[model samples]
Target: MLIAHIPGALLGLLIGNIIDRNLAIKSWADLRTRLPVRAQPQLNAEQVLFMLLGHLAKSTGRVSAAHIQSARAEMQRLQLSAAAQKRAIAAFTQGKDCALTDLRSALRSHYAADKAEQLLTAGWRIAYAQGLATAKQRRILQRCADWLNYPAASFSRLEAQLMPTRLRPNSAGNELEAALQLLGVTRSTSLAQVKQAYRRKVSVHHPDKLMGAGAPPAQLRAATEKTRALHQAYALVRKHLQG
Candidate 1:
């Protein structure tokens, strides 16, 4: 094959451009990966709560007044107004009639992972609101967590926090487990990874961002507890690293 060689400068420019293009693409990808987890803008928030609460309540096979009340508490937690509450009630009624499989499909397709996690957390509160979660409800919650593709450890952490009755007080093992889970990191994670997780979680739940997005006053209030929890968890992680 007879090769017509390009000028050295032209070849150098072509290689440089290729490298620049690759770096740009990589930087864009990194930027996207670093973006904070956020709610689903397109999904209706009240309806999502209704669907999640309804599905969770029904998962126990018999929805109790307590379960219904817990759902209401979620509305209270979200600070829904009277009209919004009525709409949520209607959605909850619809959710009660839904099959678990159908709700799972809807949740997975309609919301971002973070939004889905928020909805599922609401479900957990309802399930545990009676002071303990039933075996069936726990099973259903675990399955739903799997469907959401959340880390099992993270789910365990939330589960533990909600059901402190199940844990012995001041057990470092339990506390450490809970802390790692809250930070969304495994025990094997490095300190840098722990810090990164802490920052990411804080960014996602920042008061200004949620308030600016029209999150309810109650929800903002609830975020204070979450923030405190994050700080405690980070402290535990830091202690473990220093030790």
Candidate 2:
């Protein structure tokens, strides 16, 4: 009778352990299934956007070390899970092969403009994080922004803000003047001064740089909201000055 009781006790313990592990695994699997179909391992819409943007940032054919590092930092700063971050890195390195347009369309289909803009803004920052936003990168970002319903001017403003300081304003337009003023450069400022000012201002507003400095949520929100106005103002200013 003693021997019989010991075997039954052992069997019960084994069954309990198996049940616990199975429950844990099922829970894990269910959580994963709940994630975006396109973005496995990510648990939320925000994480899906990050993964999408990370992929787009690398699509420009540059993919610098700084870009990769900055993307990782942004992921952490945004408080994304480790699994999601790894998925984002992998998806980004995969580049344009992933059909980003479909994802963008889905975002527009499912979310509001503000939410989609956040994703696009993060992508733009990631692309420019490497210190240069090439034409190819710009096009990719622009398309994404457009699909996400972000005003076209937003990209221009962000680009203007990102431009090197040495780029002198040659246009006579109000927009040009405003951009110059925004960068703290006067019409009489020397080319060198212009470059320096641009560098300083650009660095201050650079998303990756701001991320490193632990920028506040309000500031980030403001930047996104105001980017379109800035772009329009910068464009008018650049055209006028350059003419």
Candidate 3:
């Protein structure tokens, strides 16, 4: 029997190569384990908006018919397909069940400034669906605004802009104040200043402009209401000033 063997140096070199290859493979695996993972996909703006609306509706302990109606109105305005509407409902339901912190985090992750403002406007509409926002609803909405980097004052302003007409103050003094606030002016402001403010508010809240901007039907209605309020406010202010 003849036994053939490779030289010791060649065998040693082959063994070294195999060891190096194994080490390289192990290093790659270790690096992979250490690498940052891709984050879970964040919810989109519509989902977050609907979820927040759901959370807002449930904030006071029970969801009301008005809240459901408001959500449906938003869906209609969006012209969502039947499947998308179903998803919106699911997201809203999830919002009712999910933690507030989770919803806030999702909102912050998914929405930019303008879009976040629009979502917050929708939230205000939902909160005011039954005329006025309850304390719990206001707190939830304020927290959401804060999460989106909107100041508390801005939240209050937005709330004022969307306040239900039937719920607005009817007293002479309060009406005057609300008018001034709506016009972004004050009693001390000159008539010229008041006119400027009124025009500015009208331009911003005009239903035509809102519609042109692709605002939903619900938003258009809100804008129309706001415009009407602005006219009333302007007239009241002008009357008070002229007299």
Candidate 4:
């Protein structure tokens, strides 16, 4: 009887150990999930917009009068009052000379996904305001898009919208080149190169991936569209290569 009781006691101890270990694992996971989010300093939308405008202007090598005027127009459209306009202007001036870190922080803290989208659009308008975008403007715009966390395909689509084209939207011929540009490759690009670029894009915009990276719900739709566009671009490239 004592021998039988000893085995039963050992079984009870084993069960207790298992329960304790499971509870500990759960507690650690909860602690990790509940880890506090670092608060970003609050920033004014108008000020951030102009600062970004300033940063882009410098990207093209000169903050021209036209550039400044375009920013002023955006300010007016936003209905900023005289005092607010001055503040925005001040931010723009300061931002022009500020380091890249400041610009990036402002973007991360001040703008949500939709606002970031609008800012990208505003950039094209500003660039196109003086006619066709220069090579420098295009290059700088791409860099700005990167800093703003805008996907390559989304950047291409937005930039294409402002460009003059006789072909209707969704025309295969038009999309072929745009698709190449979106993938950050050219016509002469190898299939391997295209695939690599496509995978990089997918990693950046996948929903589970973005959510894990703390992407907001508003941006999840953007991520979805980016992923779709990437698929389209890759499909076009693969078909072209096969043919």
TM-score of each: 0.47, 0.45, 0.53, 0.46
| lDDT ranking, high to low | 3, 1, 4, 2
lDDT: worst 10-residue window of model 3: 1-10
Best by lDDT: 3
Enumerate clash totals for all models, in the order shown. 0, 16, 0, 0
Query: Which stretches in model 4 have alpha-carbon errors above 4 Å?
Result: 1-42, 164-243
* Clash pairs, model 3 backbone: none
- Report the C-alpha lDDT of model 2 over 6-124, residue by residue, as the tens digit: 78779897776897677654566875765677834423465456556656565666556777776777777778677777766665555435666646545665455667556666666
2-71, model 4: which lDDT tens digit per residue? 6566787798987768965776645667756667888865668777777767776776677888888988
Q: Is candidate 1 or candidate 3 better by TM-score?
A: 3
Off by over 4 Å in 1: 1-43, 164-243
**Rank list by TM-score:** 3, 1, 4, 2
**For residues 1-243, what per-residue lDDT tens digits would candidate 1 score against the true structure?**
222478778878787789667756456677576679897444366786687788777777777898889888888988999998998998888788877776666667755478756866787788876656778778877877888887889888888776645444667877998999899998889999899999999887767788778889899988877888999999999999879
Q: Kindly provide the TM-score of model 3 when superposed on the true structure, using C-alpha atoms.
A: 0.53
| Model 1: residue 178 alpha-carbon error in angstroms | 24
- Quickly count the clashes in candidate 4: 0
Top candidate (TM-score): 3
Candidates 1 and 4: which is better by lDDT?
1
